[model samples]
Target: MLDRYGFEPAREAPDRVRLRNCPFHPLAAQAPDLVCGMNHAFLTGYLQGLRAPAVQAILAPSPGECCVELQDATEDGEGAAD
Candidate 1:
């Protein structure tokens, strides 16, 4: 699924997954806020469609990667560190 969008799993921990690619690259470069928000929405919906309620997608933009990240919120879900 992520592969189709040019997303590569840069890192994966027990409670988080980091993406190394942004599908909307050139566009995102032009408009970070807009494209990043859409990316977040799409990932959120994707998780919901998969019936994965424990995982949540949020805007955690960083260099050389997608703006949205998947964090396993099973334990408190908020700012808890891995």
Candidate 2:
């Protein structure tokens, strides 16, 4: 689904995956909070629907970087941020 959103993998690590290219560029530039939030929700739902309880979507937006990052979920079923 990242491809469908025009995001391509930029970096990969044991715990995280960074993606680049925003399909919603212009709109994201206009409202980062909204766009990023939606992106996060979409990814979260996607992962949940796939029954991937060990993975999660994180909102770690960066310029020229993916608005979301797929990361290993912590033991509490939450991402590292918690």
Candidate 3:
């Protein structure tokens, strides 16, 4: 499922999903802020469009991994800003 969106999803915890690779590596390398922000927005909308409103896309950059992560919005009252 995630593969189709260029993400190799990994579960770090019950409510957290990490991405192993970035499809827009070249562009991200050139402009991490711009690219990551766009990715976050896109993922957020994507999740909502899929009717998965509980899942939120966040920009959580990590070394050797994609900058975006998907987490359950039910945790700690944390979720994407509406």
Residues 1-82, candidate 3: write the lDDT tens digits. 6789787899999989999988888888999999888888888788988988788888899976789999988665864454
Error of 1 at 48 (Å): 0.7
Candidate 2, poorest ten consecutive residues by summed lDDT: 73-82
Error of 1 at 21 (Å): 0.3
Instruction: Candidate 1: give the clashing pairs.
Output: none
Give the deviation of candidate 3 from the true structure as CA RMSD. 2.1
lDDT of each: 0.82, 0.79, 0.84
What would the TM-score be for candidate 3 when compared with the true structure?
A: 0.85
Per-residue alpha-carbon lDDT of candidate 2 for residues 1-82, written as tens digits (9 for 90 to 100): 6776688865578878787876788898899888888888888898888988778888887897668988788934654444
Q: In terms of lDDT, which candidate is strongest? A: 3
TM-score of each: 0.85, 0.82, 0.85
Return the TM-score for candidate 1, rounded to 2 decimals. 0.85
TM-score ranking, best first: 3, 1, 2
Order the numbered candidates by lDDT, best leading: 3, 1, 2
